[model samples]
Target: MEILGDRKFVEVPGTATHELPPLLVRMSPRVRSLERVLGMANDLIEQEDMIPLPAMPVEHDSERRRMDLAVNLVDQYLAFVQHWQWGHSILEWIRQCETTFDTRLELRNLLRADLWPHAGRSSFVVLLEDKLIPTAGVEIEKAVGMRLTFRQPPPLKCFSDQFLFYLNSSVAHTAYQTWAHMIPSPVSSLPPERFQFQVVNMSLD
Candidate 1:
């Protein structure tokens, strides 16, 4: 029998340590121990200047599995820290891996939402001369809110998803029909013209 903090634990004969780890003695004490170790580790890591590199979005499932493996490895290290309380290497490595997952998630979300559109890259605005005339001969409204010139950044709205879709869809129906016929027909009773043109009509719509 041994006492850890205020509680007493009975050690079983011939029982492997893995069967009932020391941290499992009490649920509440185990959680508090982990939190305390994490707090101290944070302070030490910051003081030692051992912060991990900024995490990037994972490009493949394999990368994701590697990241998860790092997390499980960190959890194993925490058992070391819970007892020794002086495993700086253990704590630092754990903090680095765990922090990357959080940071990468936030960065990925920001890239998907705020940075998704080309026009959202910057907030800067430019104005044209009040007397400027458009070469396209379109009538300009006298309203103050009307923007009569291109003032946005390089990519502009032309690079946006909607604009790209519009540009691709601008081809004439006759051109699409001709292009579709150039391909060999499948083994079906439908005429070659109907088989391909139907696909073209659906795509245009």
Candidate 2:
């Protein structure tokens, strides 16, 4: 204090002290601006009936809702794939029956067509060709629910390769033998009891 006894300090004439916001609060406007732009874009996109995505306040409920939506979509796709595989399987079973019984048959003509997936227009001649069979790896994976998880492998091996094994197994063969005689002559509709596939479900690990 003794060294600069005459020195004096003064504030600038027009300067005034003001408190600035914290770092996060100061940056929020920019972030929120970007968010507004993104939200508008997503809203416009969703006008075409796209699924709504969860955003903001990341928490368990939002996360679970997102997961449920995803799972529902997966279930729907699986159902479609299963129907395809089943139709192919039924066509295959019919061919085997034709070979085993040494006779031709047709589906019963009903007033209203069934909604079940069918192989090739529900006609006798169209199903004879093996072109509609599920042979690709993707088809098999979808049908048998194959995955890279640590879960136990499905009972059957490659479904396409081992189709005959399951189709002619004791359970399936007995089911067929029991119901074959009940089908109407020339035209018949095989019910699920007569023929159906066992769908393998894959649970989340």
Question: How does each model score on TM-score?
Answer: 0.16, 0.27
State the lDDT at 11 in candidate 1.
Answer: 27
Error of 1 at 24 (Å): 12
Q: Tell me the tens digit of each residue's lDDT in model 2 across 61-159.
A: 765654454444333333333333433444444454444323312222221133222221222212222133323223322222222111322221112
* Candidate 2: clashing pairs of residues: none
Regions of candidate 1 where Cα sits further than 4 Å from its true position = 1-31, 52-74, 81-205
lDDT of each: 0.26, 0.30
lDDT, candidate 2, equals 0.30
Tell me how many clashing residue pairs each candidate has.
0, 0
Looking at model 1, residue 197 earns an lDDT score of 8
Candidate 2 weakest ten by summed lDDT? 20-29
- Model 2: residue 107 alpha-carbon error in angstroms: 16
